[model samples]
Target: MPDVEGHPTREEMDLRTVLNALADPLRYGVVSALLREAEGTARTCASFNLPVSKSTLTHHFRVLREAGLVRQVDRGNNRAATLRTEDLDACFPGLLDLLRANP
Candidate 1:
């Protein structure tokens, strides 16, 4: 969970990192889902219903978190995730829109 806890700050995010993290379709789906999800609500990872294995899902989540596209918080015994919508909008402007439209 150390890497999970090491999410990049908004100011630290770069276009390259974000795009690289999203290179996979699974990761892209993750962001797309978050974009439409309600704000201030963190969804559990299992709720995504990805067809990948557990480790694959972890890889996707780690990439999104490290890229600063998502914020994950530990809630009781589980982890919850939410999109960093404002941060991405400020950094890349309309990137989320593109993802939502394309995904």
Candidate 2:
């Protein structure tokens, strides 16, 4: 199946893109929190409690989505995000484990 709007397909996900998205501290924190959740759990962007403006947060999500590290969908007035853990694991084995180990 195709991915959500603005997200790359699993086969299209690139290691460089994923790494670059996680390179940002804010985005990394978002992913880290999502990683801690049960698989397939979805959290609204605001739930992350990021200390950035709405526009900035939106940009962060966009980066993650485009990198194929996240899957986001509009939920009423909020956008909810779930980490693409399965996809990430399929594309790059041990990547999530590395992130978990380092953080």
Candidate 3:
């Protein structure tokens, strides 16, 4: 079986965790990129143009995953990340709009 990571269910996500994840400028940029992407789009971690090093990038992704704002799937040697847009919208109406506006 292919290795897979876990994500928090909508109910598992809370405002505090999500807010903490977005508090970082780099992670917020990740959210911004996802917002501009086509619906349900997922991108590889290396695709992000952030100036952070490899370790830092991994840390950022983990924070986002733990916060339930992003989902990462392992595909062979690469991992793809996607925004949990629908889930977030369902849980907190207009939250994505707020992120986009205030980001």
Best by lDDT: 2
Please write out the lDDT profile of model 3 over residues 1-103, one tens digit for every residue: 2114658888888899898999998999999999989979999998988898988999999999888899998889878899999899998899999877875
lDDT of each: 0.84, 0.91, 0.88
Question: 1 or 3: which has the higher TM-score?
Answer: 3
lDDT minimum window of 10 residues, candidate 1: 1-10
lDDT of 1 by residue, 1-98 (tens): 22439778777898999999899888888787777778766898889999989888887888888888888988886678899888898999989889
List TM-score per model, in order.
0.88, 0.94, 0.91
Better of 1 and 3 by lDDT: 3
Candidate 2 has a TM-score of 0.94
Cα deviation of 52 in candidate 2 (Å)?
A: 0.5
Better by TM-score, candidate 3 or 2 = 2
Error of 3 at 15 (Å): 0.4
- Candidate ranking (lDDT, best to worst): 2, 3, 1
- For candidate 1, the TM-score is 0.88
After superposition, the stretches of candidate 1 with alpha carbons farther than 4 Å from their true spots are 1-4
